[model samples]
Target chain A: MDKKLEPIVKTMQEKFSAAHEEFRGEVHVFVNPEQIVDALTVLRDEYKFELLSALTAVDYYPQTSPRFHVVYQLTSLANNVSVQVRVPVDGDSPKVPTAARVYATANWRERELLDMFGIEFEGHPDPRRILMPEETEGHPLRKDFPLGYEEPQFTFNFEEIDLRKPYVKE
Target chain B: MGVEQKLGNMGVVTTTLENMVNWSRTNAMWPMLFGLACCAIEMMSAQAPHYDMSRFGMELMRASPRQSDLMIVAGRVSKKMGPVLRRLYDQMPEPKWVIAMGDCASCGGVFNNYAIYQGVDEVVPVDVYVAGCPPRPEALIHGVLTVHEKVKAQKLKDLAKS
Candidate 1:
């Protein structure tokens, strides 16, 4: 863990009951999905972790207990340090409390997470898909989502494919 | 009297109306001023001073579809952009042509996925396909010449059908 972030991590762990682990000097603090907003608030207002660098979700499809880990990366310009906050969300329909209130940048980032991972954000001012086409059926970034490959037409299959290929007509 | 001296004031040359019409159409096949992705850069290069597409009578790239006769689909077509392409193609006047200007616009190139449409042909009828990741300006010129060849070959009766 970064030496500068030690006391801040200690405060977050002690006060919010956030458990933290360090990998090669970078620190990640885990908090409950519901308590994420409060944890981010305390880190921002008190510890000066002002910038919300990123907000994204990681999918663990087969693991139903905690299927998704919503990641929030915070950067403190004043203290010259960064910390990552992770919220483990469980079940098929994972829901996380909106962090938009605490960090203004979280608005679009959370919308992207919602679009790609289908993770619902409680109290999100506008809960709409940010990237994909409006009528796009599934969250494309999910593990179970289809790779969306189309079979390439090689010489052997060209004539066969051409016979059925839907070319636009006059 | 010599032939030149006798025919100084008047001369008679004969050609069919069909030949005249096709000749004019091939000369002034104004392409639409539009581009989608990276290939658009190459398309611009083809128009620029270095390669100069003006000699081919395509210097005027019209912004309005109603006035244009050719659409050089310059790059990949995303699913969101497919409908707009079709709408523009429909708005173009009769006897218009389409040149799918790159591998991406031709047969999806490397983007065989959900977001990008498999190929632009699924949206609008393509006349010539210049195959390249982003084809060289020479290749685009070649494609234009091919369209001219096609237009020249058309019979007068065929013009009525379009």
Candidate 2:
């Protein structure tokens, strides 16, 4: 960590007692779901991490205890530095406070997270599917979602495949 | 007047109605001005100065489906876009030809997942399949030529039957 980030990290540790790690020159802070907005706000207002670079989620499905990890990447134009903040939420009904209050960019990113992982942002301005169609049934990015593969046709199965191939009639 | 007098201007150019109709259709086929993905770039390049697709009488790419007789489906069709594509095909007048202009449009290319339709043929009948991730402009022109050949082989009586 740079000399400038040290004090911010120290303050964050004192305030939230959040676990912090340094990897690839970027600080990673693990915060409770409730403290995500506070941590991000402090990083933005106090530490000069002005930009909300990205807000996305990772699905660690089948591990039901904490199934989703909502990640926020913050960049400081003044300090010329960046940090990642991660908040883990339960699988059964994954919910996190909207970071939109801190970063306006969080609105669409949270919608994408909700669309892909079925994670909910409690105070999201417009909580709807961002990428997938409105009628899409399941969160496609989740590990449990099927790949929906279609068997490839080979010479051996050519005749059978030909018969099964769907063709539109005139 | 001298040449007409010398030749008598009496020669009859006799040909079957099918041959005349098919020849005209093949020579003046107009393609739709629609593109889906990366392959669309190649399609535009084919229409550009270098490849010069206008040489085949395909100079005008009509934006409206009603005026176009050929649809060059130039990329992968997602499940969402599939119905839209079918609707566009439906809007086009009869005797329209569809060219599946890339590996994706022909057989979903590398994206055989749930999102992309396996092939565009599922929605509309394809007259030609141009093979490439994004086929070269020359290859697309060749596909167009192939459609021309198919058109030339059609019988007028068959059109009536359909």
Candidate 3:
């Protein structure tokens, strides 16, 4: 456990009953999906973690119970320290409280999370797809989503590949 | 000075209509300012002082599609950018040529996924395909010269038909 993160973990454990673990000199605090805003607010106001460095999600697909982990990385400029806060949400219709109110940069990160992982950030100021096109149908980052691979053209398969090429003819 | 004086002394030089038109077109091939990804950097480097693209009559990179005669698709074409690429290709006037300059613009490079179009040929007809991850300035110059050669060989009747 980092000495700097010790106080944060102790406060989170006492206040919100959040569980924490340390790995590679970094601390990760696991909090309930609904308690995300509350935990982030406490970290910002009390610990002076004013900068929200990153807000992203990891999809553990095919596992129904709490399948998505929305990870928020916070940085403290004054202390020169950083910590990660993770909130687990159910796979089916995953939803989490918006941290955009606490950190303005979370708005785009939350939008990207929704765009790539299909995890909705409730009460986000502008909830729209950030990376993908507006007409894009599916969340591409999901494990089950197809990669849509196309075979390469080589000397052996040149004729076959050329035939399949979607060339526009006038 | 002697060659210039001799040429000046002669009033006119005769040439075929096809040769004359192809010569003029090849000498002043203005490429459009179209770049999509990292290869765009190489394309710009090709135009810089060291490579000196102006020697081949490609001094001007016109931003408007209407004024350019060549389109150098110089990078990866993402799914979102595919329509825009096609629209730009369509906007160029007749007798225009396309040069796919780099591995990505030529064959989607290493990105064989749903996000990127496999090759730019899927959208527009390519005249010259330069092969390189992001080809060097010399390679781009070679590709430009290849386009010039192709333009030189074009028949007037064939151009009129298109």
lDDT tens readout by residue for model 2, B1-162: 224456767655666888778888987899999999999999999999999999999999999999999999999998779889989999999889999999999888899787888888778888899999899999999999999998888877788998
**Whole-model alpha-carbon lDDT for candidate 3:** 0.88
- Candidate 2 residue A164 Cα shift, in angstroms, is 5.4
- How do these models rank on DockQ, best leading? 3, 2, 1
TM-score of the A chain in candidate 1: the value is 0.92
What lDDT score belongs to each candidate, Candidate 1 first? Answer: 0.88, 0.88, 0.88
TM-score of candidate 2 chain B vs. the reference: 0.93
Model 2 per-residue lDDT at A35: 87
What docking grade does candidate 2 earn? medium
For model 1, the superposed segments whose C-alpha errors exceed 4 Å read: A155-160, A168-170, B1-13
Q: What is the fnat value (0 to 1) for candidate 2? A: 0.49
What's the TM for model 2? Answer: 0.92
Better of 2 and 3 by lDDT: 3
Best model per TM-score? 3
Question: What would the per-residue lDDT of candidate 1 be over residues A27-110, giving only the tens digit for each residue?
Answer: 999999878888888899998988999888899988888999999989999998999999999967889989889988889998
Chain B TM-scores per candidate, in order, are 0.92, 0.93, 0.94
* Candidate 1, CAPRI quality class derived from DockQ: medium
lDDT of 1 by residue, B1-162 (tens): 134447776565457888778889988889999999999999999999999999999999999999999999999999879889999999998888999999999989999888887778878888899999889999999999999998888898877775
